[model samples]
Structures are given as C-alpha cells and as structure tokens.
Target: MPVDQPQPAPPVPPVLPADVELRSPRPEDAEAWSRFLVAAQRDTYGALLPAAFGDDDLAASRIAALESAFAEPGDAARRIAWRGSAVLGVASASAAPADWEVALGLVPAPASRELDRLYVHADAHGTGLGHVLFDAVVDERPHYLWLIDGNERASRFYERRGFRHLDERVSTGPSWGHIPMHRMLRG
Candidate 1:
C-alpha cells in the first residue's frame, strides 16, 4: 500500500499533560542524558528506520555524538520532558548553521530554523512525550528537520503538523547504517 506524503496545514500543537514536566538541560543531566540518547535512538531505529538493527553501532554513535555536543555548550536550546526524575524525551535547536541544510541537502529560507533533534525514550511511547518535546522546541515555526527514511510514525507526526518534505533523500550520517534520509520543511 502507498503512503501519503506530508502536506502543508496549520501547525498541530501538542497537548502536553501537566505531569510531563518540561525543563532545560542541566549540568547534572549529562550522564542520564547520554544514556537516554542512546536508548532513544536504539528504540527508534531498531523499531523504525532500518532493515535490520545493530545495537552496538547505535550505541557507539550515540556515545561519540553526545560526548562531543555536551563537551562545550554552544548556541542551542534543549528541552527535556520528564516524569518526576526520569527523562522522558529531549528536543533541541541551534542557530541555523551552514552545511546543516547542506548536510541534509535542504536549503531553508533565511526565515527558517533547524530543529537539531527530537527524541523520546522508547518506553515513553504513547504517553505523548514526543509531542510535548516537539512543542517546546519547534512548535510549527518555519523550520526543517531530517526525517529518517521509512519512519512512518514520525512522518505522520510532522504531516499532521503541516510539515512537507523536499522530496529528496540524502544517504547520510552513521545512524541506521547511514540510511536514506530526507528533509521536511514547514513555515
């Protein structure tokens, strides 16, 4: 069966429940955040992006990227969703950087922003943390993000929020055996 591609519509705001607390990433969350990052990627890709899963590769990649990003804070905002002390999800955005669009082979207009990451721990699925985290970061502004190829759940999420893809796939990055990924843009 063929799936419908994303199309433009009004942004669908996330309905975050009160218990799903939202906060800025703290210095103390480094260790937990790293673990959360790996777990989230493993679950997301193992379940969605790949034809087959490799746990070790995803773990290694997460270690490499998380360490490098948190080593020095730069122009970025990270929003964390939590239930009590456990981090449910994480989302972030930095000043639109050169080559990021190029990396994803996307060219956002000067008015757009790049949503760096939006990840929710696998266990939080269906609890709506993903929507909450997304709301905290992007919230339907003129923005673009790389969507892993074949990620139907995420595709539907953004599609519902009016994000449309550029119809180009970039075989890029280390995650999911460097899967074919594409950029989704919305204004």
Candidate 2:
C-alpha cells in the first residue's frame, strides 16, 4: 500500500534556539553523547536495561556502533544533531544486514536504508526531532525501521508519520524485554 508522506512541521520556538547544527560526531562528543544516552534510556526505553548498560560507559559502546557505520570511506554517514555542544539526536545507517538478521526482518540492502537507531534527548521530546530524522532517512530512499509493540508512544508516532506494519514479531529477554511490533517505513 502506498503511504502518504507526512508533512514536516514549521519551525516553532525550540527550547534551545541556539544555532542548531547537524554534523558528524567527533571524539570530543564522547561525553555529550554519553550524557544524551542517560536521557535516552530514562525517557525512551524507560530504564529497562541494567545499570551497566544504562550508564555512561554504554554511551561509547553505542556511539561506537554508529561510528562503525561511518568507518567506511564512502556512502556512509553518522549525523549527530546538535544544539551547540549538546547532542540532541543521532541518525545513521549501514549496509543492511540480511532479512533474518535484522529485527522484524528489515532488509536494509537492495536499495534500502535501515534506520538502526534514531533517538532524541528527553528534553527535546515532542520537538519534532524524530520527524526530522525520519524524513532524512526516507528522503534517502527505500528505508525501514522496526517499531517494538509495547512502545505505544513510539509506535503511534511512526504510524502517524506513515510507517505501516509489515510484520508482527516478539522479542524476549531480561534486559531486552519482549517487543511485539510492526515494521513500517516510507519509500
């Protein structure tokens, strides 16, 4: 089914109106990105992970995954949305893993980009950062993201934006609880 592209919102009064810059992440951003994850886990995922995973140490590891995507010379990018020194959000894509390897079987290959992780700081929630990042991915080409089921706010957000359910899968674990979900995207 063809989905109607959601319209972007006009700029409103952003909490931090300082010159917003969306650029590549650098070594200096390690601390800021770590701090951002504190808010990410607390707000987005509800602090469901262990203390070790939710702490600052995990930030470097998470950022490393994103950095690896950019490690390659060409056709890869890692963008960190910033308001001055603060890292508000991040968006990156890599060679899509095979269908079975990715969550919800989102095949990032064959002319598609997989939105591995698109997160915004809690302070910036509802400021349209998610929409902005998603638009960036969709505009790139065939793109996909797996929305876990129990995350209603996120699921609804994606649905409202035009992602449709391509599948219903369940994931279970202690640290990574069951995430029943639908896969949605834009072309």
Candidate 3:
C-alpha cells in the first residue's frame, strides 16, 4: 500500500472586483508586466519552449519585443487594466504581417489587424477583465485571431465573445502539441 500526497491549497480568490480602469500601457509598466506574464504563462502552461526558440529567457525577450513594437512606426496600441498601481490585465492588437497567412495558412492575404496578446492575472480571472479586454481589442480594430487548438479556455472565451470558426487544420508547437482551430471575429 502507498500513501498519497496532499494537494496544494487553492489560490486565494481576488478581492478586487471586475471593474478596472483601462488605459494605455506605459514604459513604467514593463517590469511588472513582464513578471506577471512570465508567471502567468508558467502556471497555465507547464513550461515555455517554442521549437527550442523560447525558454526561461523568453519572458524578457517578449518584454523587449513588446516595448519595441509599441514604440515602432504605424498604428499600434496597448491597453492595461489597473487597480491603482497594480496591473490586472493587458490587451493589444496590431497590423498583421503581410506574410502571416502564407506562413500559417494555405491561403495568403493581408489582415487588417491581429490580436497579438491578452493576459489577465490568475487572481483576476473570472472577474470580467477578460471580457473587458476582449471588447477593448475588438473596438480598436476589426479583425480575427488564429487560436491554437489545445487552448480550450481561450477558444471558448473567443466563441462566447462572437468569434466564428474558419478552419480545422492542425499545427504543432515545440513543447505543445497539435492545435487545430481557425477563428474569425465579425460584427
């Protein structure tokens, strides 16, 4: 007979409500934003390794990329939800690369906009920030995103927010497996 180990206690629920002030991300937000994103990604997905390209150092790289992208020429925007000095979530959309479709899909065309990323702290989950962020992104640009299949929560979230499925092709990431879902968001 073997003894079983006890499971860890669940995270404490957030006292903060869903109502958060949304504003543009500032350079000052880089540190906390990087920390939040790194921890969130690690908690949600075991480890981060995209084709041996992304590792533990990926978070810093992502932060740098985000900073650069936001500062680059052309229309780019980032919204951060905040409760005082604390950052609750972030959402961003940008003009997609001309070659995005060719690289990711059988069809090749230009995308008006693409949802680059959206992340809400786990403490803030179920607090309506996700919906808020989604709405902000949609309001900023008329576009769609290609969500990888294994992310059921995200797919369901998008579906609930009015995104429609466009394809069912499978694609693989480094550490993650096949993800088969193409979705479009329309008014």
| Ordered list by TM-score, greatest first | 1, 3, 2
| Per-residue alpha-carbon lDDT of candidate 1 for residues 52-138, written as tens digits (9 for 90 to 100) | 344443465665665566655586667877778888888987667446455654554433577777888767777777777777777
Runs off by more than 4 Å, candidate 3? 1-21, 47-62, 98-110, 175-181
Model 1 residue runs over 4 Å out of place are 1-19, 47-75, 98-111
Output the number of the lDDT-best candidate.
Answer: 1
Top-scoring candidate (TM-score): 1
Error of 3 at 173 (Å): 3.1
Weakest ten-residue segment in model 1 by summed lDDT? 49-58
Error (Å) of candidate 1 at residue 86 is 2.1
lDDT of each: 0.71, 0.61, 0.64
- TM-score of model 1 (CA atoms): 0.70
Per-residue alpha-carbon lDDT of candidate 3 for residues 95-138, written as tens digits (9 for 90 to 100): 66435455755354224777766888888778878877766666
Stretches of candidate 2 off by over 4 Å are: 1-18, 27-31, 54-73, 98-111, 172-175
- Minimum summed lDDT over a 10-residue window in model 2 is located at 172-181
In order of lDDT, best first, we have 1, 3, 2
TM-score of decoy 2: 0.67
